[model samples]
Target: MKFLKYLLIFLAVIIVIIAILAFVAPTEVKVSRSITIDAPRETVWEYVNSLEDMHQWSPWAEKDPDMKLEYRGTEGKVGSVYSWDGDPETVGKGEQEITSIQAPSRIESELRFLTPYESKADAYVQLDETGSGSTRVTYGFESVSPRPMNVLNLFMNMDEMVGPDFEAAMSNLKKLVESGGSSGETQSEMAFR
Candidate 1:
């Protein structure tokens, strides 16, 4: 009886602590990773901006080679959406829509995860010309977790979880662009007003 009482007290304390931690935890999580690809900004932008090209450099796509993908709207332009369904907890299911674009400089997207868990993130990629032949690309995503669920971040470091994926994707992007696999000819045609 004494042990049971002590256990109840301990559990109560843990619950209180967890509640406190959740309230104090950050509501927003952002993870970003950058790399310099040995190609012009337009060249890199052409690849990154294209929804179809994501299969070539995306870490998640690399995880599930046979994942089902669907596309809608104009590719590389705002409102363009790519949806994917895959196995494993890593890929799960999600749709990402291009929300904004700034030609060879920036692209903003909305990422909506529907399976495993439902969450939405604002994703973006920034491209900067570093030199005559090099372009620095920054890819990132930011999500705001509501209330108690945000506290899950206290135990799980979102940055550590997603950063590796971003890094891997960036590395693949670098390889694809530098190897002349991405065409520079399509850049001017894709530039939107």
Candidate 2:
């Protein structure tokens, strides 16, 4: 009886500690990476603005080449959605919808993960003219964890987890743009003209 009582007390203490930690843990997480490309902002924006073009340089796509993809609405404009279902152990499944576009400067989207876990994040690409013919591209995502789930943020280093993928994707984008390998103007780009 004494051992059982001790065990119950121990469990209660642990729960209280976890609850406290949950309240103290950060509720928001952000991860971002940037790369300078040897191409003009307009050229870089062409690829970044189009979901289809961006997928061409996605590291996750390289991880699961056979991943199934689906698109809805206009190719690169607001309200457009890009969805993918891939290796459950690697890429998982998710959909991203373009939320806003600021011409050659910024593009924002909402990302929803459906498998492995369910979560939503705001994703963005920012472009800055670095020089006469150079552009700096920043890619990032931010998510908020609510309530007790915020405790998970304490264990997750989102920057460490997603940074390398962003780096590789940026490297791929740089190579493609520098090689003059754009897949051509997307509907959004054409409309912007």
- State each model's CA lDDT, in order: 0.84, 0.88
Q: Which candidate achieves the best lDDT against the true structure? A: 2
Q: Least accurate stretch of 10 residues (summed lDDT) in model 1? A: 184-193
Residues 40-155, candidate 1: write the lDDT tens digits. 78778878776777656788877886799999999877999999999847699999999998988998999999998888999988999987688999999999988788888888
RMSD, each candidate, Å?
5.6, 5.0
Best by TM-score: 2
lDDT of 2 by residue, 113-149 (tens): 9999999999999999987689999999999999889
Deviation (Å) of 65 in candidate 2: 0.5
For the record, the alpha-carbon RMSD of candidate 2 to the native fold, in angstroms, is: 5.0
Error of 1 at 82 (Å): 0.3
TM-scores of all candidate predictions against the true structure: 0.85, 0.91
